[model samples]
Target: MQLNIFELTSIYLYITLAACAFYLAIMFFQKINRTRGSGVDLGPIFGLGFFVLFFGIVYVCWGYMHYFGYEYDFHPLPLYKTGILMTYFALIGVVFFSEKIIGKTKFAFTFFSIGCCVYGIFFTFTEFDLRLFTYITNPITVAFILISFLYFLKVKTTGEIRKQMFSAFLCYIGFLIFFLLDIEGIKALLPFPMEISSIISSIGVIITLVYLGTIFLRFETFTEFGWKDKLRELYIIAPNGTTLFHYSFIRDERNQDLDLISSGLTGVEGILGELIQSKKKLKIVDHQDIKIIFEYGEYTTIALITYENLRIYLPKLTSLRVKFEKLFQDVLKDWSGRIEVFRPANHLVNEFFG
Candidate 1:
């Protein structure tokens, strides 16, 4: 079977629309489940879902128009423009409402949504005049992509959200690059046809959609870690002066050896978890002045205490005892309060006894 470029483009667009519809439906239901009992705002899910549905339908219509060669009015009147604006308003309402409801970053969502709204309005007016609209919307879209990319990059400091945000950032950059390359002026400079540019742009869009879908599906996983994890770690390591440990030592409580604290240090928690597990003894020197001491092998590492958690991993075992002490001292020197580190007076005896 032979297929023309137009047919292939339509097929791709249809597939994209179908995937988007399924994604929106799933997210809508998930949001509904959360807001079922309480008097929570359903605007975000409703708005987002509505926009997705509407956009999908519009694309389908466009596809049909292209396939059939229908002389459809691409441009709309002022009233129709108002209706398009309403769609954007719905999107904005949903983004803001959902951000508040879900306790996500508001600024990021607001900027991206508003950018989309502005672009939507631009497209609405320029439908009848592609040349004018192309000039305006292309630059505007590129600017939005850059802004969104930066925002995602900034919010990605936390390890949990970093991967998804990075993926999103790549998508935006990809789109921006494609648009820049596909412009008539740029195409003239390039040897290859513009079709290659479209393919690359489409791939970027696909990646962006996948990342967005992953984020929606794994909302809990991408969210920042609450204070509970820190509190729990602190509670467990209270007996030990060293509240923080290397990432290699922390183990889940289930696998922890009741008789040997070191056993708990070997399991899979981050650096902080391992430190709490590795320490032989823990004590609070003064309640008013929080301080922690850990006895590891033949050295005692002391630290002035703070709520901040610490996780470090020393990959090598040879001469680890000295390395651990030096690391602890380095940390102490950076802090404001006084901290001390001392080798055990009877090092040989301590080593022999242990």
Candidate 2:
């Protein structure tokens, strides 16, 4: 059976969106399981993933409807899709913000929810005029996307993730403009078949999915370490419970007891592993309202004791672990546990992640 352009586009969208959803789920799972230093919660991303899947299904149904020349009006649909999408994105902002004042901002979520409700109700009672409704919702959709992109720009110090996200947002905005123009009956101005516009829109969505997948999956190399004053203490320990090196803001004897802290943390690690039945290397312990974070290296494990938010300090910790393991590979092999040999590590702490 020969498929029309719309059907083929829908099939491609289905495949693309399905892949996006699957990758997002996998990323979230891996993120939760990883023993990284930072405690960036990947839970909020699930909302974005589900949104992609829902939109995928909606596109499929919409294509079939067009293919069969079947026309039906679902007045709430426009509001629902856009509103819920903005809501999901707002939630994502919370995850990215994580413990920041903006992350604590419930206003965005509240505003989006109210907008969706009002838009849904307005569309339900009033006639669904694509032109008029597009006029109302399209700007809001574009503004939300632009604002999200701008926020990402402002907060992102590492150009890698920022660049990827910025590219995705650009594509999404292009697709949005095309979609609105098509709805406004301006597709004829394109001087090309409408099918070409559809193809371009699909391409935009696909590119957006690719970038989002890459950024959220932690596949990018982030050189910009933003943890300046957040990290309180860091320790590198051998597999045999020997403390290789440690740095702390606290100069007292109590904080200098790396051996005691390492042993205790090791024991806690075993108990937690057995309890959870998982081998994740990252561990966070709360004591006296302070966070104790652990990140494992090849022959050593790094522990960070900090009062700062885990989400903010984790990536820096991970960088410290990697740099230490690589720089001290030779020293780490011998039986000697001289803390003086790792003196250069202090410079590392002061330079890369300080």
Off by over 4 Å in 1: 1-12, 28-32, 35-55, 70-126, 129-145, 175-204, 221-354
Give the TM-scores of the predictions, in the order they appear: 0.44, 0.55
| TM-score of candidate 1 to 2 decimals | 0.44
The all-Cα superposition gives candidate 1 an RMSD in Å to the true structure of 12.3
Model 2: per-residue lDDT, tens digit, 25-53? 56654554562445443334444444444
- Tens digits of per-residue lDDT, candidate 1, 160-257, equal 34465576567546634753553446757777654454445445545554555455445432222221122222111212333233221124535433
Candidate 1 global CA lDDT score: 0.43
> What's each prediction's clash count?
11, 3
Among the numbered candidates, top lDDT falls to 2
Model 2 whole-model lDDT (C-alpha atoms): 0.57
Alpha-carbon lDDT, every model? 0.43, 0.57
